[model samples]
Target: MSSPEQRAAAILASQRFVVIGTTDADGPWTAAAQYRLRPRGLYVESDLGSRHARAIAVSGTASGVVYDSSAAVADADGVQLAFSAREVDATEPAVRAILASRLPRDAGPVAELDDEVAAVLAVPTKRLYVLEVERAYVFDRDAWRSRGTDARIEIEAADVWAALGRP
Candidate 1:
């Protein structure tokens, strides 16, 4: 059994990836986009006025998937993780600057946002679901842990919200 600190480290160390889920008017929407893991959260880039930017504005909720396929390539054990997150717009100059420093230049300039484009995507995690693989056997973390999923050490939505201090 892993300790709480180990579990936390596991989550923190996992490389982030992207998945596309869809929304109609103002909820979860779909699109396959590339993203990377950062210490703060998941970071993705898109232009303003794009479907993703608009959907995030309308719904404020989104989901992403990250897989540890390294194991597949390395012939080692691995896990796939899914994240439910809320998107925060990096529209403010300061936020844009912070994102700019972390993201590539082609993503869009921090200062030169076209009237129609959004700058950056700030995805704060709310929930995480992980699937573990052992010797080609796949199982949910709960099953691997011999307990309910809730029994695993994870940050609750309230804890994430408090840490972000966002409304």
Candidate 2:
């Protein structure tokens, strides 16, 4: 049996991005953005001009979801964990390097040309939130509930780095 930590790590390890949910005076907004899981928290790069970036700057609240699709349970019942956090600008060289490392290769040369991507680089924020896992449920049609828990998981940055086998 997979320990909760291992299972959680697997969920994160398998995914490179998360749907960042933000709120404004109007209502809530959700968008899927690429993220780099680091020894500290989750890192995301966005254009300073994008709606999401503006939202993060004005309000630090955000949410993310990670799940296990390989479970024996039904497809709809895959184990999923949703979380929330506070945003921190990943402006420093060290943090940028960490975030860069987590980026999917398919991200292309978007960050390669320093001049063209300057707007995004300026706001490369690492989201540092309380990471409240709102829920964890199996999506399987029949055996879903038997496979998961609605437990609050405390995942530190070190743990993420450990799972990645990074120092």
Candidate 3:
């Protein structure tokens, strides 16, 4: 049987999509996002006008989960994470490099997105947000009558990104 820590590392490495839940004046909101896993946490790129970005700008907090959709019920596993999001300053060379790595499918190359063209298209400059994971939990799929999962493990990797080197 695989340990939960191993399950979490696999999830973080393999999953590309996550649903982030946030709060607004009305109530709770959720956004489906494409994310990249880094030792720093989950790195997600979004434009400023996106509701996801707006919400993060307002609250700087969110929660999300990632899992493999193709797995069978008995074999399924996932990671639940609570995190905070902060905008990355694109002017910094290191930060811009990260942003460049997440180019939009609809957009042309970075050089083509000059300020003039970008402004006319309402293409808000890509903003990098790191989901600074606060709490991470690993679980498996089970029957309704059972405890949510047989082996619940709290992933403490968020403290120092130790999960990155899980062996």
Candidate 4:
């Protein structure tokens, strides 16, 4: 059987999008954004004016879920994350590297990718955000089987990174 860390890593790596939840003075908000996963965190692109983005900017915190929507109810599995989030400058080397890694092999040269990223970030409203995960949990099927009730098991962030073959 797969460990919780393995399950979380699989779900995170395979999922293309995450529904991020954030809060502001008015109330809570959720928005889905396509994501690229790295050992450090999950990266997403959004507009600075977006509700979720604005909320993150204010609170510096967010929670998100990544799951297979196509899965049957009985077989459903997902990762729940609590994170510190912030807008990152696209010109930063780390940001550029993350963006470049997500591109297809044939997408083009590194310089071209940097140009594209720059063009997008140049829009006053657009920004790149990173969610640095603090805590994570995965659905525990073994617990469900044993107790006949849904349950989640906390997986260490280090374990999740290790599962991804990172230090």
Candidate 5:
């Protein structure tokens, strides 16, 4: 992990829904997506047949906002990332391990997915996608810290991780 990666993970842990923005020839589109953080990217499991899924597949590029909305003031802490997204090999060891670990925690949307498929409709076609950032900026109250995919910021990722660990 790196500083940007650390910041990204913190943002993910602190927030549940991400605003996903994409564009097509006719116009721009956006949707709120539930996500989980991975070492190198973020994961979103969505209906395979939906427009949200189709947009990501067609463009591969996306920008997302993850914000801690419980601020005392009008507008506050958040992070925004520009990234690429694609369906992942769910069986890949790393991906599998990460998903499994988060499952027990019942993190956000993962909880809904863990339900018995005993729903009105048959189990839907849902696939996990990896959203890897090309660049990102973190807004901590009033200040901003930014880094490219290279994480040109000087901080070590490990330090950031340790500091942000949940008490």
Candidate 6:
């Protein structure tokens, strides 16, 4: 049987997008965005003026889930994460690395990558956001079976990263 960390890694690796939950004075909101996973957490790109981004700016925190929508209820699995979110400068090396990784091999040479990153950064409204996960959880099937109730088990972020083959 796979460990919780392995299960979480599989779920995260199989998904391209995460549904992020946030809130403001108005109330709670959720939005789905494409993500790039990193050892520390994940990165998402969005407009700085977006509701989610604005909420993150105010609260500095968010929670999200990544799961397979097509899975049967009995076979369902996913990773739930609580995060400290912040807007990261696009010029930062890690941000640039994320941008570069998004480029296709056929896209062009190094110069083109530079141009692409520059163009993206040129847009004042667009920003790169980092969600530094504070806590992570996965469904505890053993507990569910034993207790006849659904539950989640917390796992270390490092374990998830290791399972995903990251340092």
Top candidate, metric lDDT: 6
TM-scores, all candidates, are: 0.43, 0.56, 0.72, 0.85, 0.62, 0.84
Model 2 lDDT tens row, 1-167: 65545555666667666677777777888877766555434566555566666666677556666554455644332234445444444445543444344423323464564542454455444232223344443233333356554444344434444655552
Which model, 2 or 3, shows the larger TM-score?
3
Better of 1 and 3 by lDDT: 3
For residues 1-167, write the lDDT of model 6, one tens digit per residue: 88889899888887889999999999999999998777558878899889999999999999999989998877778899999999877565755776654313113477777676777788878888888889999987777667767889999988887777764
CA RMSD per model (angstroms): 10.3, 6.3, 5.7, 2.9, 6.9, 3.4
Q: Which stretches of candidate 3 lie over 4 Å from their true place?
A: 92-94, 97-123, 140-152, 158-160
Off by over 4 Å in 6: 90-94, 97-112, 143-148
Clashing pairs in 5: none
lDDT of 1: 0.40
Specify the poorest-scoring 10-residue window by lDDT in model 6: 99-108
Error of 6 at 157 (Å): 1.0
Write the residue-wise lDDT of candidate 3 on 1-167 in tens digits: 65666677777777789888888777888888888665546777678877777888899988888888898866777788888788776555546445444313222467754552334334447777878778888774443227653664576764325545522
> Candidate 1 — which residues are off by over 4 angstroms?
1-14, 20-22, 26-28, 36-40, 70-92, 95-97, 100-139, 142-167
Which model is ahead, 1 or 6, in terms of lDDT? 6
What lDDT would each prediction earn against the true structure?
A: 0.40, 0.51, 0.68, 0.80, 0.60, 0.82
lDDT of 4 by residue, 1-167 (tens): 88888888888777788999999999988889988776557778898889998898898999999999998877889999999999886565755766765423113576687686777657877788888889999988777767778888888988887776663
